[model samples]
Target: MSDSLDSLLATADVADRRDEVVTGVREHAGRIARELALLQGGDYGSRDFDTDSGTWTVKYEGGALQYLRYDGGREEVYVVSAHSPPDPEALAEALRDYAAFVEAYNAYVESLEGVLDDVDTDFPAVASTESVAAERDRVLDRIRAVSGEMAGQLHRAEGTDYGTFSARVDGTRWELKRERDQVSYLRVGGEGGIYLLSQYGNPPATDVRELVGSVPAFVEAFNERVADLDAGLSRVEL
Candidate 1:
């Protein structure tokens, strides 16, 4: 008789819990279904809310509802199963709130993406100033090498007296004359009277390296003259 009485009481409890689940879903089913459709991923749309009992959270995972409760005394959060306390009604309300938060969050992300797509400005990397200066130095080193070699060749050639050198190439005459024991002068003429290539008085050197190092234009002119003299030296004498 005692077993029979216990069975009847358990049956009533089951019936009451079933009624509560049904009532909760019926009141919020439309909203829950709509939000679940928008909420994607295995675990998303998480939101927390305060309740008379404590704090509770709701989310969707793998197309199913999940509920969580925070225990302040333990400082830990644990899952609230459907067969547990706080009932399905509270879970539904939290789910609706969380889903709404998710909707707003997704809309904001979409708007930010649109704005980024319209940004067309491009920033390209460029060489540093030090790298550019290094490149210029390399070019200048090559120039110095060629000029020194040419000056040596001209110094040894015949008719190059007192470091005096002259050559006419492409209708332009370039001349470097050692004027005194300590000084020299550079001149250029093109169907007109010769003009000084060196703005100031020059220093004496057999290779004309001093002149080449000092004046930019003189180095180019001097190299051209040396090249012509070198070609002449290479020819077979008749």
Candidate 2:
């Protein structure tokens, strides 16, 4: 070939090589972006796209420039295109940064797993405090006060005509009877009631205050009956 022809051919070859380099580098960036998209999971929208060059995908929450994908090869391209191709060196640097970020994130997740592995499944027992003791004392004191008041009222109301004093409250029947020296009670629905023998037979107290206080079932039944002032007392008559 002539000298000029040889020179023209050489220039054409260099241009072609340059085009090839640009195309290859842009494609490499798209691959890196796709890898990032895979790691991204549900972080954003990801879709497979076919282009004149190849298929590519990129995931990002917004049109964030931080996503290193090409922009100009085809219409509505989600990745690098001819118009806004990524600088090869810059894309390489970003890929390195993304690698580091991925490594750190994975390490952080592994650290959390390690922490979980070290966790104790059994919960530690909670110790009671002075405040709890104080609260208990208050509750017992209230119960005792209520019991004393109820016993006094019942004693005043009791007469020689001790047929069974009974009341139905909240769909449950409760009966109180005077047996010689002690006043005994029975719950038609539940387990507790005064008896001559056996655990179920024990009377709450011989002393009036202790009597009402010891029988929680009686106290609860009495309280519910008396909740409506004098109306409850009237309901318990006879």
**lDDT for each of the candidates?**
0.49, 0.46
For TM-score, the strongest prediction is 1
Off by over 4 Å in 2: 1-125, 159-166, 173-189, 192-238
- TM-score for each model: 0.24, 0.23
Error of model 1, residue 52, in angstroms: 5.6
Reference-based TM-score, model 2: 0.23
What is candidate 2's lDDT per residue for 1-238, written digit by digit as tens? 6987767644566556545755654565555444445555543554443343433344444322233343233322322443554444544433434434344434544655555577788998888566655654455456445444664556555544343446554555545554432344333334454332222433233322333334566566676655655675667857
Tens-digit lDDT string for candidate 1 (1-238): 9998777644567657756755564345334433543643333565554544345444555444554444433343333445444444444454444444445544644655556577767868875667555654454455445444545556556434466656554455666555332124445564353334343532233223422344455556666766877798789587
* Model 2 clashing residue pairs (backbone): 70-79, 70-80, 71-79, 71-80, 71-81, 72-81, 72-82, 73-81, 195-201
